[model samples]
Target: MIISASTVKDTSENVEKFVRRNLLGGIDHLVIFLDAPLPDVEELLDGHPDVTCVRAHGAWWGSTPPGGLNERQITNAALISRLVVGFVWAEWMFMLDGDEVARIDRPVLDALAPQQRAVRLLPLEAASRLHPVADPTLFKRLLSADELQLLHALGVIAEPKQRSYFRGHMSGKPGLRPSADLALGVHHVVDTGTGDRVDTVKDPGLRVLHYESHDGEEFVRKWTALLSSGLDVAQHKKRAPVAASVAALLSLGLPEEQTASLLEELYERTALDDVESLTRLGLLVEVHPDEGPRRPRPPDDEVAQLRELLRRAADVNKRMFKPRARNQRAPALIAKLQRGLR
Candidate 1:
């Protein structure tokens, strides 16, 4: 089965590591869509025969919605999806965010090979090593398998919790059939025919390592980018209050320096100490290394079923409901009008 993976990234940090990890995980090809110009992109792709890089030149930016999906994610789903479908000849395709890494095994690959099937992976959020103010370059440094093990052993970073307060945490990226008419998301795919999400292969073996907020500098940069983009503050007001507040503040002409400072303070107050404390308390468990083949989930064909159901409903409606006569009136009403005229 031909399986390919694609991601749209602007930053140089973790790009090489992300590509290498997917290649090692048995993905047949890697397509990188650069949202912004990265100078070392050519050198980065030089040795990898399977990897391809394409620069978007801000085409993806204009497609961003006011509320729902961010520009980067929309670009990935709408822009990169087309690119992958057009050029890459693959039975199944996986979408990865710039900071996310997929850990796919043999059985998972086998599960993904079937037609009319999509596999949803789990997400593991990685914790940062440095606190307060940390360098962005620290994220660029590749963490060896041994180093990850050591960090887990030392309780510096713990395995991601299976549950999240955020929506769609359990339902991660979809490995989709390329031919399906669908609108892709980071966690799910909406079938265009039925306007419903395609059923997912609910296998625990498929996991994505999400290195969100790698360091203070990176965190600031990410938030700054979002704030500057004029992201809809009202959209995230309930789901993410802090983000909404930041957006509101920026929109109100909050200076960049002041906004950055506020964000740093908020980060320190909210996540930094809490993460350390939780690790110390052993609230977050360490994920053990697994060398065995991962298990495959049964195929789900709910998308096809839903599409058929919708078609039948439409047909039934068309046959049962007839158009009214243009000038027809109720018999009693017509008689009353005639008597009134007389």
Candidate 2:
């Protein structure tokens, strides 16, 4: 059977969406470790047959305080991955994030060769806020050499340094064979007994759709905490450039509103701004996101209602095209960031 694990500190709505979507994607059970003191998800999935919510106050997180969020995730994933063998009959267990949803129609491990101990699912990052194809969300992925050339030729990314195609991670997450003495690390699976990384088979068909901060409000909300929290995320390869910029911005200690204002243009430029061009170029793929909840919910948690508001009102979508020159408003932001760097 297919199972998944995650450490989430998200609102009930997003949690509900993630659970239902993954369940529909063929995950038999989801082991969710609550990393927050209070988020409505535990009550939301109180007795879900297919979900187990391990609270922060429970014996789980109580053993020791995690050094940081990523540490917590790594710990939780390893804990459940090792522990799941006792209670559940599972073949593959995926460790992803609350902001991520696996695009697995049927996660079958039985067909995998005996040596294929783990599977890697590359992420397709959410780029647009609204698309005619909102059945799922519009996400950007790493292009092939030819596609990368097309992007450069069309000036989609403009400078090589400007965009990394996918903004979050390229290493991907793993789906491990639980019986293989496996533990989920930050990005891949490891043999707990030997402390060696497992050989991973990268599945192009199976992927993780990441809904990172798609707007300025979300962009600030997500990054401000990390940049200022001393998480040392700037050392992360994919995140270093932007993380450094945001950390620099935070050092300025400018008013919250000013920081957000400065980041507006930067967010637009780095985010997948032109969906139409990407789609035409076959750089975007569409998946249908499940709107129904795994369990019955209050009025606010309904999918039919949430989907429209989420698409048309709450979130915004943008077109894809050539990367443009930096906006006039961004220079002061840059100057201030430079000052912070000093």
Tell me, what's the RMSD of every candidate?
Answer: 15.4, 15.8
Q: Which ten residues in a row have the lowest lDDT in candidate 2?
A: 314-323
RMSD of 2: 15.8
**Top-scoring candidate (TM-score):** 2
Give the local distance difference test score of model 1.
0.49
| lDDT for each residue of candidate 1 in 1-342, tens digit (9 for 90 to 100) | 334435454455467766665655545556565555677775676445556555444433334322323544443443333223322233466777766766666566565545646777666555543363532221112234664555566654453222222212334677765542554556676564554667877565776666566556656665666555545545754336656655566677778798778777765543342355445545443442222232221122322222222222221111111112111232233233224222
TM-scores for all predictions? 0.60, 0.75
lDDT of each: 0.49, 0.62
- Clash numbers, per candidate: 0, 8
TM-score of predicted structure 2: 0.75
